[model samples]
Target chain A: MSTVTKVSSRYERDKELFLRYAAIIESSDDAIVGKTLEGIITDWNPGAQRVFGYSPDEVIGKSVLILFPPERMEEEMDILGRVAKGERVENYETVRVRKDGKRIDMSVTVSPIRDSSGRIVGASKIARDITESKLLHASVLEAERHFRETLDHMLEGCQIIGFDFRYLYINDAAATHGRHSKKALLGRKMMEAYPGIEETEMFAFLRKCMENRIAQRLENRFDYGDGTFSWFNLSMEPVPEGTFILSVDITNEKKLQVELEKHRDHLQEIVNERTAQLQEANRELESFSYSVSHDLRAPLRHINGFVELLQKKLPSSIDKECLRYLHVISSASSEMGHLIDKLLDFSRVNRASINKSDVDVGSLVRQVIASLAEEAPGRSVDWQVEKLPDVYGDQAMLRQVFINLLSNALKYTGTRTTAKIKVRSISGKGEDIFVVEDNGVGFDMRYVSKLFGVFQRLHSNDEFEGTGIGLANVRRIIERHGGRTWAEGKVNEGASFYFSIPRFIEQRG
Target chain B: MITRLGRILLADDSRNDVELMLLALGHFNLANEVDVVRDGAEAVDYLYRGGKYAERGGQNPALMLLDLKMPKVNGIEVLRTVKNDPLLQTIPVVVLTSSREESDMVSSYELGANAFVVKPVDFHEFIESVKNLGFFWAIVNEPPPVSRNGGEQLEG
Candidate 1:
């Protein structure tokens, strides 16, 4: 009777500790439930009631398959059979159905509980909601796949390599031309994959890219094993993790470049040949003109000499008409001779070599004016001489320029009784400009373009006695000195002729 | 008068010029005689007292009028030979030519010719120049004395 009383008291204490554990499990947020080894739900705490939307009374006799998704219930039974073999399952994440048929992701930890005889009595399970973490993992996997697809499928051949010269990745196109598969290519050194590539400029170029840790593009020739060679345009982009190379085959483009260079050389040869022919023709024309002028003088001299003899012998025998005819013929012959001489002079300016010296323009102008005055002492004119600069030029040629200009001024200003002629100098930005201005019978400005052309005249021959070659000759001489000449004039007021010479005479200096 | 009228030598290639010269010489009524040669060779022969001209000339002419352009011996060669000879050097040789080119003028003067004149083209001017030349050389300018040795030889 004492033993039975003792057993009853121990049972009461064990029931109290069980009630305390149940109260703590009910207050927890984690779903705590008990299932039979046959997969039937027997015990459910308030935490399980809130999590699965099922009360303890409603789930006590139901199968645990009520919480599993319909598609996964059979799979759960197989997994539970494994768990019942004394294997505790941890972190088994799966989709489950709640009371309202809503799906939720839960990570489950289940342990098999044992009785005094060590036989499995039930299974205790702890399930937690992890839906947000599962969705985040899925998006990360999708982004990684997208990045890999774009890099592999890009049109330009791309390769990623580690600093140890090991290739981490090569696209499908780059691997196809190689002797190895993409899997075998990874983790292989650059030289080991392509043996001769180490000796090429590409090797040095990659070294530079690595040292600078910058992007570089290299044009190099790659000799394939089959005795064929190809040119590759390689772009190396250095990243902190590794280096990326983008290669393009440019062999056909290089051949086109060589052909273009040959074509360019041929075109230059044609131009050189044409220029030679033109220069030969020009030289022939110039010599022809020189001979025509030089030989023509002899015959005209004979005609003049014979006519003079005829005039003298016919003193009493000739009539006034005959004398006048003889005078006219002689005069015409002389004028023709003068014209030919002037033409030759104009043409010869280009043929001669220039001898340069320091020319004092001031004294040169004075001498020219004095010579002109001596030629026409009877004419009254006011001559103005200005201070002139020293220029580097051929002294004789410069003297010829001043002589022609000043003489032309003196002759044209004949109509004015007290003609005023001004010789002055002015400074231009980088040149010395001199002007021989005359208040004389100026010409129409509209015909100024014709002024420097040989035999171009603005006045009637009877009015102005000239062969009309002076200004043309002057223009030629000044141009040869690296200078320019031009004139401005009105109908009758005056004319000013300006010419400039570069002070720095580089040729012959 | 008799000595002055002794002889004169004219060398010219043109027939017309020679005829005019003779007519103008005719105007000078002095007792001076005139002889004409067609080229420099004949002139050289007559002055050197050679071949055909050995016996015709009583003495060398007072002056020789030399025309420059002729076949065989040219005027410059003739002048050079004459001036080199002791007997012929004393007699003044004047260069007369149709060429008025500066080279011809300068060459004749440089060769020790007494004077150079371009033959004028007009007929009247030609006659007047010849008349003036004749009056000046024949009458106005004093003539160098003639050589007395019968060996009055020319070198050209």
Candidate 2:
């Protein structure tokens, strides 16, 4: 009961283990098969029938070459050779054919099967389908290519910096902005690529953004070793790996702002210089007028005074010719005196301070006319006065203007039996124009340009008794009030003098 | 009829002007009582009894006719000095000048000048104005009595 019974029991246990192994192989998801060295199928499992789309009876005697594509038949021979030599092939990926004539990707392992005599007779092969994994790997490669293309096409300069302050990735724009190629910049330190970026505010900002895990924006000027400078608007963001940077050029805008500021300062300097020169000229004119008023009149008075004493002391002793000569001297001296006085008056108008108020021009003219009528009671003059507008100006200066113009009309029209003087006003663009029309012995229009010039005369002393300063004074006073004056006349018709004053616009709250 | 008063002082730089003024005063028979000084300094000296007139004994003149543009001291300076002095403040001073400048007139009045007159260019008007000035100051306008003690003398 010992030796014979123990040997029988051990043999039965070994047979049971072989049946369990076969059961596991048949139910596995992998295709398990046994083939001979000549590549003929000897045994097939349920997984092999499921994968090849063929049942066990149909493929039991078929060659293993039936499972290979036409171009891969040589691969099977090579695999069978290795298996026959007792060399195991593991996970050798290749193509295979299914029952439906479609191609599939597969990974296979082949091992030599041995008999009890220790001689290799066939190969046991296991294959796994890998089509889904191959498809996923191909799609991942395509996505990487798309991302690289998008970075190359960007407008802003972009760069990725490593924690070691070296370049990890740089786009096309970033390479151009840095004045370097991507091949030269990648894996290179910022100082190595730009040579002096460590000294620049841009490098400092990037370092700060990386260290503090914050975002920052700044402007910096870079000097390229060739004596040229460029300004950039830099923005840096802290990324998980390192720092991301974007840069934009702003050199032209900075240059334009500096140019505009220079022009403004230059214009202000020119204005100050011109104002100083004008003030100097005005001071000289004032001194000249003061001297003319004081010194010039003294000699004229002495000449007239001595002549009068001679006439009074020797009235009977003087001959008619001598007396006439003396009279000429006296008259000429008096005329010179009058001329001097008028000249001083004209200059005073230029230097006097202007005091402005609402002035009644119509009533002032009426008063002047009444005085003229009283002075020339013998002559009958027709006066036509219009309703005049009140203007803002120096009242005394305006009165002087009216007096001069009206007196000129009265003087020129002395020859007329019925002299007509018309004073009227008309509204003009941004101003009020007053015209004094006289129907009298009018002046020749040929000398109209000389009317407002100082000491310029339109008529001889015999024709009109005047020192030729009234119109000049009238022009000066009007000009000081920000107005203009002009005269129009014919040889014998009438003369009309026109003057315009700027209209005042009142400020309202 | 012109009544005689205290001495009249006239200050002028021009010889011809002084001669004419004297001739005009001669017509009023008051020329002897008038004193003529060549410059403003002489006028001041005559009034203060200093310089050349220190030896002479007199009171302040009843009227002083001052010309503005004179050498050594100007009429404005002379007027300022005389008006500030207590003994000479009561003396009437007239600015008679050829300058018709408004600033000169205003300054003369501001300096306590009793009258401002522009000398006429015509000889007849000059003579007539001088005659009227002589008669009015020497006869029509009464002057304060002589202040021997340099004291204030108010006149009616």
Candidate 3:
């Protein structure tokens, strides 16, 4: 009887311990409940109520289908059948409806309950609320999707390589640059995937980045496999255990640089050709000058020598009339010598090199007039020179042009009573056109064509003491200044000589 | 001392210039005398009393005026020959040529010629230059005593 009483007390203590464990499971956050194998809800704890939005009163004796979503009813029945067959389902997470009709994520553990006779009578299920964990996972997946979309749409190619140089991820831009699909690129080694780029600057830069464990950038060219080359500015950044690269096409910039270099080479070639031509012309001019100095002087000396001889050797018995005639011959020959010298100087102007600078044309013209007036002091000549425009040209050359024109006007008009000479400027066709007009023995219109030719004189030698080289020199000077010269005249009337200079010629020279 | 009316030798290539020079020299009869040679070779032969000039020469002329441009031998060679010969060096040689170039004048003077005269173009000027040349060289000037080989060998 005492043994029976002790066993009863031990049984009471064990029963009390089991009741305490049951209360702990009920009051804990985890949903602990017991159910019949026939798919009925036999018990519901507070955690179960919280997970399924149902109380024990509302859930007990009802089918467990009340806690499942409508779409998951079949799956719930299959699960219940499996539990009745003595199968325990552990950590079965599924969607359950709350009391507010909201779908919540729950993990369920269903185990078969057995009596001391070893027969399964019912099942106990532990349900835990896992909605927070599920929300975190969904948010992470959304973020990854957004990142992939952004990278794929970028203009620059983006690539991610593993520590072993295998492609972990590549955006659409990178796939297009490699001329392949993203699926083909994944899990492929960089060298095997893009064999051409393996030994290129791109590979070298990537290797450097890997070695240094820092970011690196390089500009290099790549063959596009279509007979064309593309330039790229590649930036490689070393990430933890991997490298990320961005590439921008710089082919257009490289093309522009090549074009500029070609242009420079072409310009240099032109300059070199022009310089050679100028040097050749200068050599010819020096020889020409040498010929002029040596050859032309010989004839003048002969003319002077013969004249002097004739004057000295004439017999005293010769007629006074004949002696006077001999004197005329000697004077004419001297005059001819002077003319030849002037002609030589005129031809030399062609060999002159132009040097452009600011020139005071007004003062130069006044000086010419003053000098001419002094030369012909006896003649009453009115010199009217207008305010001249400041010009940019070879000062000595421009002075020569004006001097020739003025002197010609003065010389031709010597016969006129109170000879009137005028120097003036007028605007014409974006040029400064200067005119030297004279009221004197004018040239015929027919003879105007021959005016600027070497030794082409319109008037007879008796009428003028000129070598006829003046106008020709004037023409050459104006032409060398990038200008033109012309004359208008009628016999016995006045003559006007005009010349113009282009504005750009000054700046260009 | 021998008088100043001794002969003057003028070597020229041009007929016109020789004619003119003779007319100028005609005025000076007593104090100065003029003799003309056609070319540089003839001038040298006449100075050495050889060739056509060997027969009737009495004495060497007082002075020799030589023209530059000529056929056969040119001016510098003549001047070089005259200056190199010790016998002819004492006889003053004047270069009277139409070449008025400074280089010609400098070279002639440097080659031991006494004077270089550029003939003038006008006839009156030529006469004046010739008159002055005769007056200065014949009347006013004095010549060094003739060398043994320089003066003419008077045959008589």
Candidate 4:
């Protein structure tokens, strides 16, 4: 039969079926059109008119090539060629141009059209606009790529492990931290890449996070199988695949802490050894002085005793010169004895440990002046004393210092008809300075350096008799108390002796 | 009542000190009242009348002048011996020494020394100290009467 006759016969036999198909094509949201095998449109629906922004009358005789862009025209030809051979092309996604000259995304399906006699004459096509869905999908893919790129470039190591403990992904930092390339670690089991890793504490923690989907953190000193170890502050979180881990290397900080502790311990040991050595030296020095006092004084006593006895046994007619020589011998020997005693006193003050206390230096000075007055009761002395302040020092030792200073003031001023001895103390920034100023026969400034030396004297024995150890003892006592001593004098003028006790001592205690 | 003669014992290691001590005691005319031992051991022996003094028997000395730093035995040990003994504890022991060490003085007093005197370096002061000691212990200060146990031990 002719094609037109066959088409009419099919429609004439199933008028109800023809009406149902016609209504579905007319109401469908997708574009439905009938085209000749040469890619021309013969029938068009309202959906097609809305999709392409064209009316059915304007496109019913037009070729389908008018709907495709130049780049998509080639693909349309391929689709039409397949449809002409009774083959169907389903979901052929492509780009197209609309009547408004705007580009749109589309998914199209084309099938062969058959008459009642089962012969193909043309094709039927369906197309849907998919521009909004395609835009959403492209944005999702871009966001995923951003996260991947960020993880790859981070300084802290980032890694993703699969449920089977295989390395699914490793960032550049993670590969560098592990001292391996990403190509070598990816898709490889952790235990296979790092032997004995399964036995490690880090592995146990990672397993717990992977299996329980729990988050955990730890500090791990990872040993690299090559006898090298590194420290990492590791934080793990449960991810969909298995676990995600971030690691920060802290080996330098750990090593610095260990080195600091070792250095402190070494310093403590050295300090302990030095303290022990000082204590031993002090003990030996104490014993040495004890024997010196006991043994050295014996012979002096005998010499004096024999000299006195020799004088007593001599006759009354003994020569005056001989008698004078005997007197010199006795006096010289006694002076030597007194010098030894003074030397020993100085050493004892120097060697003994001191106990610090608040001392009333003013009252102490008064007491010394009273005692010194007893020694030189006959002298007409004009004493000008000031109120002195208190200080932190060894009470007994400070008393010794005052005794020496006051006695010196009293002795040197013996030449003065009216001795003016002023005792006063002034508070300094870090020290409390006391002064024993005297209007006495002062010394030369050139010899001030020898003022505090042991057995160093400014005057002759005949001028002012002394053992020359008073200032020496004073210096020793003051130094032991962590103080300084200085003297200012001009010959025949007044002399000022100054000593300072540092105030920091009280604060430290 | 058995009257025990008052005898004094002087113990010193140095011959020079012993001679000087005797000379100073002579100033008070009490030298003959004293008996001497050269060292701490000799003094103990004489008190017990053991070795050199065994052939000679006498009463415990009324006073003992002890010096520290002696050979064979020390002054503290002798003082310990005498103070621990009931018979000899009654005799007054005075430590006269050249050592001014506080430890020696503390030890002497803690061990029951009747008096402590540091021997003066000056011969004149030495003689003055001896004059006072001689007059007080031997002449003025009354010695404790010999213990009844000591008298009985001697007589029995």
DockQ, every prediction: 0.09, 0.56, 0.15, 0.57
lDDT of each residue in A326-404, candidate 2, tens digit only: 8999989988878888888888887789988888888988998998889988888999999999898988999899889
Tens-digit lDDT track for model 1 on B93-150? Answer: 7787765445567878787888897665444556577777776776776666544342
Kindly provide the TM-score obtained by chain B of candidate 3 when compared with the true chain B: 0.87
- Candidate topping TM-score: 4
Question: Can you rank all candidates by TM-score, best first?
Answer: 4, 2, 1, 3
Candidate 4 residue A363 Cα shift, in angstroms, is 2.3
- Candidate 1 lDDT by residue in tens digits, A1-509: 78988999899999999999878988988788889888888789888888889999898998999898878978667667866898888888888888999898999988888888998888888888778788888889988888888878876677887888888889875675454688888989988888867677887888778778978888877777888877788999897757888888787899899889989989999988988998888788665664455345445545665676678778686789999998888877777767877776777676668888888899888888888889898899899997999888888888988888888888888999898999998887667898999989998999999998889988888998888898998899889978899999998888999999887746424
> What CAPRI class is candidate 4?
medium
For all predictions in the order shown, the interface RMSD in Å is 5.9, 1.3, 4.7, 1.1
TM-score of candidate 4 versus the correct structure, residues matched by position: 0.73
Alpha-carbon DockQ of candidate 3? 0.15
Which candidate leads in lDDT?
A: 4
Better of 1 and 2 by DockQ: 2
Question: What C-alpha lDDT does candidate 4 achieve relative to the native structure?
Answer: 0.86
Badly placed stretches (over 4 Å) of model 1 are: A1-75, A90-109, A115-117, A124-144, A159-231, A235-245, A251-263, A301-334, A351-378, A383-403, A423-436, A474-488, A496-509, B1-156
